[model samples]
Target: MNAAQLRAAARARAQRWLRDRGYLVERLTPDELRYMTSWSDAPIPAGQPVPQRDDPRLVALRRRYDELDWPVTAHSRWSDRSFVDFARFRGDSLYIWHYRESPRVSALKYFMFLRYVEERDHKGWLDALGEDGAFGCWTFEFPGRRPVSRDLLDSVNELTFLDRHLQLSGWDGLRALDIGAGYGRLAHRAAQALPGLRDWCCADAVAESTYLCEHYLQYRGVVPPARVVELPDVPSLAPGAFDLAVNAHVFSECPREAVRWWAEQLARLGVNWLFVVPNEADGFFTHEADGSRRDYREVLEQGGYRLVVDEPAFADPAVRELLRVHDRHCLFERDRP
Candidate 1:
């Protein structure tokens, strides 16, 4: 089929799949649910009068973060409120003030270290993003190594770090799916990096995020093969059985239902490869968003996937051994059903 025909099929299949999964499409319309609010809230339209920059709530949240010794604790507990929460927080307001704009030390340090600090090669990779502050990232001059823009850096690092394993030969007709794809940061990078890709689907559970990603992908010129798939439509829109399915720093934050559901979806799609990254150490344990603790391995096994490669998010062998406690990045290959 022609490219237009292919896109039409994907759009229709995706919408049909979402409706079957019980998501309310009418609610997603801008006239209805305008903005995303919280993890539990459905998409809703912004109130007629949006808050101005100087709004008291905005000032208060900014103050709350600014005053913190750290936006997240080194202990990395969910209750301590790690970057995991910040990434998945329900509303556009929370992300805008706390992440996209705020330069509080706590926010800066938290975003910086998790991916960039240990991943030494990221320095050269970041050149594509331009001056740090230009992208809402505040830079600190650290001797030898510098970390910047938590989400953006991490997104690029994941693609490059994992490149050793994906062995992407060409972008032509290549397909990818990113689950819990926050703001399409990786999608933006992938569009520029992977020139031949035929389809790159960004899926997220938050309605507010769907609105944001659609515009973000377009703004970043990732459309054609790069498109936002409403979270529920995941099962139907495999797009040539997605060459890679990414669950970057996301699965661990999911509830038991969500974790298992995503596992099964990727398995059902027969995806060739799966990438998993987390905010914590080497063990399989994760305290899910649903308040349930789980070992993500169980979900992977249930979905018929197997661990093929395990490595630190940072590639240095000495560093991996030195930092023995943390298990940051992993690859799981589907065990052909």
Candidate 2:
């Protein structure tokens, strides 16, 4: 058979195999196929081992976390097993990239995202918040910039997007609450980027996350403006204390009940705006520990929040597809009583 005939035969066989396995095969253009396969050649980094010496602070934090009687939903994937290494909490544990993502690919995504920001960063926030590989985070140096990480790029992208919607630049005395604030990544960035930000409170149901957030914000020396609110203390926050609430890649990791609980808190606190970055591209869904997905949008709405904006994390569809980053940035406003 000619080469073309042989290729056809192989395609047929592959399709047959997929069908037998209860999979649907879709045809793709060469460019589309190239985009999908481009990451295959990217190199994966070696895994770093957890340090032997445990910090006494982390141990105390863990004790505090263990003492609390958390609901089952709050004890999902993050608390189920040792997902984070306290010693290297900022590395791959919080905002993980090394395990399921390629370093080179992630760098490309960050570079593209930087380009996107450069066009809109009239205030030079990106330059102000340039990243260093502090706390063992993975870093890549993009062109004309210092070392950058997913934590930095994602935080800046989110901030810029939020600014566009909420005019955050002009909002003086803005108080923000971060739910599932892992390692205080966004909290640190938001504090630096928005000088008018009165306070940025980092809260998390996971004890390790709270511990790291508390340590990281102080380690970065933004503790006055940015503070970690332990799970127990979150309820005590007075109504209307915060103007905005952000939950990035957080609700998706939580169970439905946990999402509902958080939504209720936001409603009770009278937070006017909510920002969520779900893992899904098109829907608001929760990722359960048992590898199941449940819709959490209704839970938020039940708590009197309504979706105001839903946009792709990467505005350019081509860039989003090429980078394989399809997260959606969702903003919602709480309905007044």
Candidate 3:
């Protein structure tokens, strides 16, 4: 097929896939497509506004997460209410604020993560992870509640390309670390591919995610050698620990100071490669000075990291419903020593 034909085919396929999944897909201007809130009980609108029953998965999640008795709180288990919960709670308002503007994306992302968590638990990954594991998100305590079909697909594609790119670049034995290891989904996938990693740690500033990882490891019956740490002013990681440090779509929402602090921490961690996945042309945080968005590259570089790999975006089946339209690209090795 010619370029135009190919593009047309992809668009058709995308629209069909979205419709099959109950999204109302429409082509707006050539550059953008707007997915408004659907009145339908769909966690996200399949199209613009309409009425439908709430999704069963969403109902289950709300029943579980919204309950005051579900689990941890300031008054609940101290260990349960760890730094992870604190951070998430702190971010909850911010996230909610953003959700008003992009409820569909937020809701879908949350739903997919929960789904993945539930699936992993059903697979016994959670039991294998042991008692140390706990859930990370403020919305739901399980990964299964979050919908991530497009995100995962996009992640897999990005990883596939990254593997090839790194292979061509003589990148081998590259030890790595992941901050904000939400439910350990992305890190788990990366571990499956990057065999050369000598030392790798999946970390989150929050204890909840670490706890969840432990649970997930149990469910999967896999013993993890690395443990999660409290995200410090500087991470208490071993010096020269990894060749790569990655945060997928993590830094974008983080405060500027936090981003700078983490970048410096990564530099101290001795990683030569830094990878970040964010929306291609936009970020979560906004600026009042010029009503502009944060620049990923600029902030990281200012904090002492360099971009080594910048690749175009690809669609992920998990998030295809949410992000198939925009330029949601992934960047690898964004920060280099």
**Clash count for each candidate, listed in order shown:** 9, 0, 61
What does each candidate score in C-alpha RMSD? 21.7, 7.3, 15.5
Worst 10 residues of 2 by lDDT: 39-48
lDDT of 1 by residue, 12-88 (tens): 88888998999744324452232222232233234422223344544454454344442121112223322323223
**Model 2: per-residue lDDT, tens digit, 43-112?**
2335533333266766776677777765523555565545565555556553655322434555666677
What stretches of model 2 exceed 4 Å from their correct place? 1-53, 98-107
| Candidate 1: segments with Cα more than 4 A from true spot | 1-124, 129-135, 139-148, 169-171, 315-327
> lDDT tens string, model 3, 1-337?
8999999999999989999999986544422222233211113223322211244532443344434331121111112332332212212322111232254455555455334433433323323322211122223223432322332433454455555545512455666677766555555545444445444477654444455554443444333433344333234577787766767655654445445566667667666667676644444341222334555466667666655555444334544444343434444343342
Shift of residue 123 alpha carbon in model 2, Å: 1.9
**Per-residue lDDT for 295 in model 2?**
96
TM-score of every model versus the real structure: 0.60, 0.80, 0.49
Q: By summed lDDT, which 10 consecutive residues of candidate 1 come out lowest?
A: 70-79
Per-residue error (Å), model 1, residue 141:
6.9
